[model samples]
Target: MNEQLLKDLLNQDLDPVETREWIESLTAVIGADGPERAHYLLERMVDETRRAGGHIPFQPTTAYVNTIPPQREAQSPGDAAIEWRIRSMLRWNAMAMVVRANRKPGELGGHISSFASSATLYDVGFNHFWRAASAEHPGDLLYIQGHSAPGIYARAFLEGRLTQEQIDHYRMEVDGKGVSSYPHPWLMPDFWQTPTVSMGLGPITAIYQARFCKYLEHRGLIPESDRKVWCFMGDGESDEPESLGAISLGGRERLDNLVFVINCNLQRLDGPVRGNGKIIQELEGVFRGAGWNVIKVVWGSYWDALLAKDTSGKLRQLMMETVDGEYQNFKAFGGAYTREHFFGKYPETKALVAHLSDEDIWHLNRGGHDPHKVYAAYHAASAHKGQPTVILAKTVKGYGMGEAGEAQNITHQQKKLDDSEVRAFRDRFKLPLSDEQLADVPYYHPGEDSPEVRYM
Candidate 1:
């Protein structure tokens, strides 16, 4: 931990053993891969070493990313190309910092620092897909943005195709002509957590609970209604004290319309005693037991089928029929507890009945819960009735960052990336030669601002 030792470590020559250790450690922190374009951060590590006034220490192994499933036997044909395009573009965004850093070293290192916040990701994510989704199935999503995430989101959407109305609204505010500036560089919605949490949760966490109730009542998905509301979340927000408790309450209240998509890859906010230990342990199991449909898609699997064009059609069809608000109750178990057998256990635990004549998902007109029974009653009542909802996904921490040595937690993440490691990762993103490709391009950096935003 001393400066000399740290410097020495930075200067150390790496072997296969050391290289593997370094990559795994990075993956644990970044969660998915740092950037798919990079097999290793080659140039950045050297830059980091030079900045440290030492030699680069850690190195990367010769490995390839395999985040996607093969498209050979797929019902879809273009899924493969689309999948790769997505990966490459995401990776391109990741290195936006380094690519832009040369203009202003360390100034525009926005993606990593800016991205860990749930608010920022939400806004950016919206910008990334608004054109495709909103233009297509307008009714399917009513995306909400409150804090830091929404600001990024708003900007991202504007960048895609700026409009006079939209631009006028946000620009007035960021500029003096408006009222307040966007929350911090990052915004934390109502339930957002601020720095420091050693004691426990406070007011920010309170409103989060209140809004959950309101949002669910207002916009929740009904089996027959065919609507879905997604709450974009950050690592800090994910750790909110009341979050899981509220999610359980949602299930208890039969709010199957609510879907929680948590971004869990950031290491800075994810302390050890929390992130994987408590957060994942609780959410991964919480709602499934209480009559909720949970789908945990991690790695490249995060929000894929639902957002994809070719697959979106099938996804919508499956979801609509599944929730057609018939005359029966059903329980869906996905993620960790998924199996083919839960389909039959309904006969004994039938505590509820479906009575609705309208279209709805999990449309329960009547149900009886034994005061003596625990969540088991709800579990049985749900899984027994309707077509039965299913939790489609769950992911391992750091799904494909390629790190295996360290536990995916915060304490380790607090440490800085060494020079050699940075360089290795930067170089790994180098694109293959193409005769027709443009001659002028930009460099990739992990901690620099984006050139794509400027001199494009």
Candidate 2:
């Protein structure tokens, strides 16, 4: 098939059967050499499908990266709570922009893209700290990265802090409509995210907030408590001079009440943040030198078995040594590409993962996506004393959305998803409601009407 014809076919909102037919036809003509080649082609076909729908391929907008929640039957009460919150956060991230008027011109509407991957990474820490805080000892969140506001709003909405009407009016300037911006702390009484245009201000602000708490306690103005000031920022944001300029202040003041959660998705708005995956390691030294306790949370459950099997820590070294850009390429290119990159770069590591398929290697768990790892990091941060803490959690941008936006260089600008793509996304989360039902539902509802939805 010609490129134009392929694009045309992909643009159409074809059902699964038609999509398969087109794929089969293309493979027949292309002469599929093996299952891996066919799988790669299938991925390319999906990309075309997204492009046809006006959703830019490899973009990081909500339409491109907002995906279904990962399937996990909760293992414990804590796990169940975390899963419920994560699913709720994902649902809101997906529905937030879709409810807005896409036709609006200029920059006067809900954001086209929400920081889906970044938000999910930090949600575990956010939920835990928020739940534990009380009116007397109030813990606050310092949002360093501006793009992640939607996920914060999603968590708030599920926690009953926001009403359905308010959610429906998100980005609308009308009297009760949720006033839209990257983030506005004034809109919410309890939260304290000041609207910031640049990166690094969050770290500075969080340090000041922590210092203020200390001042209040010393003066007997407030009771001494374990309340913390949690700041969330991207590793890309760390490259900004403003982000790192205030590092010394945290250590100088001995702000143990401060906690920094760096979402190491490793991609800035432009491209990969670091060539090798040493951004975390590099930051570790910077923070430690500046007098902060740096905690690295890399490798999720997927690496558990592999690590357990490694007697000499070869797999861990391979993982750590894998370049960040190479990892992004693996994600953008898919399973076969990752297998080739991993095994090709380190021939000796092949024996460690040889039994696994290309698909298995590609599907390895990321630290940010794994709730258990995130919670554990947060728990450790809370227990830490004497110095400020930083959790360097590795993550994937456009993580769950599949081929449309994961790890692509162009994710920041692309926006909006077509109907079929939306339906498929819902199905992945097991929220397969009919078009009629979805249409009839209000912008925000109790969600009891649908088996899988429950955000209203």
Candidate 3:
């Protein structure tokens, strides 16, 4: 290709169709010649464009879609029906534990939104990704977020690792039998591994842990193994300097054993983490610039059909242009508002979703909540080498909490749910509890012979 002709083409204001054709042609030439030659030419073009002060259009670092294409994604090995049933049971117990504690005279409070938001994130790991320590191999290390401890406890109860007495004593650690609100190695020395109750400790420590593993392997202190360090944190937690301070070290050291999963629920304790901006895009640029593998799990499987139909790119353009504040409101207000405002702005975008009902539109989930999408990202990260990996997963703050707190600014402090909210939650999770059983917001456990129990 001639340099001047390439410059002229770059300067032209081509529409989406023309741009697509130009890219396809360029890709064909690259494929015929070989990718290495094309890479050299592209680098030269970038340098020349900078020297000439000419504008160059680059692809966005991330897209409003899953990092892995549907065809390339691996199928989840676990049975979906059994896994969902187990997740529903855990979600109910976790919520019930917090609500029951607050009803006491002391009004002992615990975080509801964090766990509600991240239940699927944890559930996926438990079922497939995370492994236990054994004589043959070292196990994966997890740094659970401080606020999401309740969900872990609920899982333990179902596994028979925790007793009902411990479940009842949430946030009242003074008693010998009571459980601590956050992960504490001292309180539960036999169970909890790392202490992450402090806001920014998890991320920094997890990075060093991965680095330390490499150090031990090089020193011949431990056998060479594929153990991984999994760090889970909130989007708001990233604001703490400690959370992102050591990410550069991870990339520089080529710590392929490390995987950081940041749950972006949008809302922090007070309000939106970045109401005016896109946090996922910002983080993507930072990680990619640092020479780390970045996988974005933005939209869920529910969006596959609509995204496929969005040939004009208008729908995606709207998704990119919308701010976090508006996204939060769309979920809070429901499907009607989302269709009216999100799609209402452009007739072409509106028509793309015309076949779906308001209810269908409302249930369109974020990527973090879907097990298949989460599994794909995890599987990819585990297999990727030569760099660290970060999965920026988008989720709803108060995920199944209904009007009590879902997507509301008051989520962090929402410790108790009313009778109607409890009933709604039970129904949403498809729990077997009747209205009468839900009256007390009691903890539920399937018998030992039940499929859920046997599957676990």
Candidate 4:
């Protein structure tokens, strides 16, 4: 969970004293029965610097100090500077631990051994599945669920299809000195992301957001013979008028080989609520009425909930009969998995992913790709549409990040960890991967598929 979550302040946005006033108000609203209710507001102050990318706003209310460590624990000039190097290594390895913990071997195509190196968790997850499956099933073009057209664009950038420098230029730096990344420093995201933040809500910009998808629809970006496109966009974006218009037009114009993933973060602004979080359910209703092939996957908090509910017979009916495999390929991706509960996910390659021990499962499907559920929907849609498929993944926001709440907290970013803290986090969270262990880990190539892969 080595990332931040955004908290949306409603009604009146506060500043310092004003913020304190609101915290008191919120505390009252939460009432005495709610334990530590004030913590949420107080917590906001600790991470202000993260608000605009990294232009740190100096630590919030002084009262926050007790709850969190001092931001400027002015050490003796001799002490803090001296430990900087050691701290840096720890931070680097800590990040690597998160990366490694997230992926089994080969998920990222190779043993990056460090998050400090330039690879994303999505990349790791996608490649891991691809490589693992390729060992058994060759010729499967690695199909993926994109969170947004930008995500697909980002993948293209990662695959060496785009240069690092260009992507950096395209990206805006949120922090003071732009952003700094390690392990192949140049491979930063081409954009800075703030929750629910966007350039515009207009059709043109919506179209821009859906840009890569247009290429996907027209068979413009990819080669037709190879596998088609799998595009991922967030839940909010799923409802954009322009996106819907594009899909309708594409369908009317006969766009094939496109897979859409509407990642349901269960949110509107900060995020959607639990239980009824997915946006696709509504969209599915519309798409189906239009004679479009769509599959709806309402999954549970763990793989078991999903697998238990998703009996093989139901899956066959969904994939083989519902949509009738119309387009040769069409799918929807959704499930409840989160990294918090199941980090370093390596699900049992057998059908009983539901029954496996917590230790054996590699996925924490809080919100990420669930190949089984998603691919089943893809099968259904592909068969029904008579066109290749779009596996629209309804996923959770902040899928792999540390914070589990809908609010991506800014305070949790570990900019620095003293000796005691660093040691503890290391021992508790990140262990190391062995050479032999690494060799057998899942490796991500591309277009690889597996029916019996373990999924926890």
Best TM-score goes to which candidate? 3
TM-scores for candidates 1 onward, in order: 0.37, 0.74, 0.92, 0.37
Pairs of colliding residues, candidate 3: none
Identify the runs in model 2 with alpha carbons over 4 angstroms from their true place. Answer: 1-77, 81-95, 98-114, 131-136, 141-144, 174-176, 187-193, 435-456
Which window of ten consecutive residues has the lowest lDDT sum in model 1? Answer: 365-374
Kindly report which residue stretches of model 3 are placed more than 4 angstroms away from their true locations once superposed: 1-21, 27-60
After aligning candidate 2 to the native by TM-score, how far in Å is the CA of 225 from where it should be? 0.4
In terms of lDDT, the poorest run of 10 residues in model 3 is: 2-11
Sort the predicted structures by lDDT, highest score first. Answer: 3, 2, 4, 1
RMSD to the hidden true structure, all candidates: 24.8, 18.0, 4.1, 23.0
Which candidate comes out best when scored by lDDT?
3
Candidate 4: list runs displaced more than 4 Å. 1-227, 273-278, 300-369, 375-392, 404-456
Order of quality (TM-score):
3, 2, 1, 4
**Candidate 2 local lDDT, 286-383, one digit each (tens):** 88888888767676778767766766545666666677888778777877787777765665567777888988988886777677767766766777
Q: How many backbone clashes does candidate 1 have?
A: 60
lDDT of 3 at 3: 55
What does candidate 3 score on TM? 0.92
C-alpha local distance difference test of each model:
0.32, 0.64, 0.90, 0.34
